[model samples]
Structures are given as structure tokens and as C-alpha cells.
Target: MSDIDTYKQQGFGNSTGFGARPALLIVDLQVAFTDPQHLGGGNILAALNNTKSLLAVARQCGIPVAHSRNVFDSVDASVWCVKVKSLKDLTETAPASQIVEQVAPVPGECIVRKTKPSAFFETPLADWLHQKNVDTVIVAGCTTSGCVRASVVDCISHNFRTVVARDGVGDRALGPHEASLFDMAQKYADVLSCAEIAAHLRGALPG
Candidate 1:
């Protein structure tokens, strides 16, 4: 059998189902990753486009939207930063660490500042979702192999139906991007394309 067919047969590509009133979670689509000139930068233009559509659809459906970014303190960064010797770089004051323009969080949207890969770790993400009464979470953004993947696992752990937009998340390496998506689909979350998510939002089953 072809590799693709073999994977499908093993349920490695099974689609995770969506649910009513899905909340949108956009993770770490920051300038550092989008600029191609900073640490962790990647080929992420296509991913951004996909996420733009997701954002529009979520707004059209009146769904709650939240965003996450990684920022550290200039004076005293998180322990992870100190341990990794990256404390001086990820300061909260750096514009490079901010979310990219195309998908920047609008005023009043919940923006969670994280010091680690998982959005829920040391952040208010879980309580915020609970407050919003979110049943499902549609996730989009960059570095699928890192923060995005971490966030997906945490989303599931929080008991939220997690949906990772397949094309809407990118990584510095194509291999990790593809491999991590496969891993997320197999155990952590539903990984779908923007089109698939749109269909679900429109009350249709995604292929």
C-alpha cells in the first residue's frame, strides 16, 4: 500500500469532529515567526492566510476569539527563559515578539501572554474558556511543532473539543510541521483545513 493509504488505514488521519459554539484560539503568530528574520521564523504566509479566513468566519458566527503570544520580562524573565538563556531576548517590550499584524488581536479580545509552549500553562486560558462557555476550540497559528502542538494537548486536557486547523498552523521545518500534525490528529486534537472548519461552522460535516 502507498504510505498515505497505510496511514489512513491506521486511523492516523482521522478527522476530529467539531461542536456547536466553537471558540477560536489563535496561537503565537508573532512577528518573530512571521518575519523570516528572527528566531523561530518560518515559511508561514500560507498559514496566516488560512488563519485570516478562520478569523473572519468566527466573527461572522459570533464566536468568542482568544489569542496567545510569548513575551518575557526585560528585568526578570520566567524561569524557563533564564534556564534556556533566552531571558534577555523575549522581553515584553520587544515588538518582534508581538503577534503579527494580519492576525493581531482586536481590542477587548482575550490575549493570553504565555512564557511557555502550552497556552494553558501558567495562563488564564482554561478559566477564560470556561467563562465563555466554550464547548469546542478552533485553533490556528504558527510553529505547529512547538507552541501550537503544546496548546492542542492542553486544550484537550481542559476538556474542550479541540480542532487544529491543518493549514493554518506552520513551523520552521516542514517535517516537524507534518509530523506534529499527524501526532496531534492521532491523539491530541482534530486537525482540519480552513475549508473543513468553515463547513463545520456552516452546519455541514467536513470530509
Candidate 2:
């Protein structure tokens, strides 16, 4: 049997399924990570497009949306900047730190500025989601093996039903991207395609 089959046999790949109310959580799809010259340049564009499509459906369905961006005013603020030099580019005033225009936040959407990998860490994300009555969160964004994975784990820990859009999240490398998705699917969240999520949203929403 394949590794996935073995995992299934061990009862590791169970689904938590969807919840009543869902929100979109876009994590760190910033210019620093989307532009090749900066820290981006992979299959990230495809993921961005998929997320854009998902965003449209969520907006039409009137679901809550939240975005997370990693911004540091200075490298002295955290030791993480010392460890990962690329993070230095993500300053609050830098253009590279801004969320890409494609999936930019619209009016009334919550924007969470975080300095850590997990969106829920030291942020008001949990409180915001609670206020919105969001039971489920559809997560999409860049660097699947990093911030995306961290945020998904935190989402479940916060008692939110988490769904990771497979095509809507990307990484700098395919190996890490695929590995992270498999890891999340087995333990943390339901991994579904953006199209699957859009279809479900269409059916779930009132006309």
C-alpha cells in the first residue's frame, strides 16, 4: 500500500467536515512573497488566481473575510528576523509587505497584522472570528509550508473548523507545498480544492 493508503488504514486522514458559518482567511499573500525578485516566484501565481476566485464566491455569499500580513517596523523587534533574513524585507512601510492587489481586502473585511507565523498568535484574530460567529475558516495564501501551515493548526486549536484550499495556497517549493498539504489533511484541516469550496458556498448561501 502507498503511504497515503497506510495513513488511511491507520485512521489518520479523517475529515472534520464543514461547519455552519465559514470565513475566508488569507495569510501572507504579500508582494514580498508573490514577486519573484523579492521572495516569491513559484507556482504562487496560480494559487493567487485560485484564491481570487474563492474570494469572489465568499463575497457574494456574504461570508466574513480576514487577511493576515507579516509586517515588522524593524529587524530589532524580533529574533525571527535574525534567523530569516528575508523577513527584513517585510517592513510596515515597504511595498513588498503589502498584500497583493488581486486579493486585497475590501471594505469591512478584517485585516490582521501579525509578526508571527500563526495568525492567532498575539493577534485579535480569534476575537474577531468570534464576533463574526465564524465556525469554519477557509484558509488560503502563500508559503504553504510556513505561515499557512502554522495558521491552520492554530485555527483548529481555537475550535474553528478549518478548511485549507489546496489550489489556493502555494509555496516557494513544490515539495514543501505538497508535504504541508498532506500533513494538514491528515491532522489539522480538511484539504479541498478552491472549486469544491466555491461550489459548496454556492449551495450553502441563500439567494
lDDT of 1 at 71: 83
Model 2 over residues 27-71: C-alpha lDDT tens digits? 999998998888887778899999999999999999999999999
Candidate 1 lDDT over residue span 1-207, tens digit each: 986777778767565577665889999887777766565555577898889988988877778899998888754466777666643466677888788788878876889988888989989989998898888998898789888999999899988889999999988889999999888888778878899887778663234
Task: For model 2, state the Cα shift of residue 24 in Å.
Answer: 0.3
Report the Cα lDDT for candidate 2: 0.93
Candidate 2: residue pairs that collide: none
RMSD of 1: 3.4
Please list the residue runs of candidate 1 whose C-alpha ends up more than 4 Å from where it truly belongs after superposition. 1-16, 82-87, 204-207
lDDT of each: 0.82, 0.93
- The per-prediction CA RMSD against the true structure, in angstroms, equals 3.4, 1.2
* Model 2 stretches with alpha carbons more than 4 Å out: none
Worst 10-residue lDDT window for candidate 2 reads 73-82
- Using TM-score as the measure, which candidate wins? 2
Q: lDDT (0-100) at residue 35 of candidate 2?
A: 85
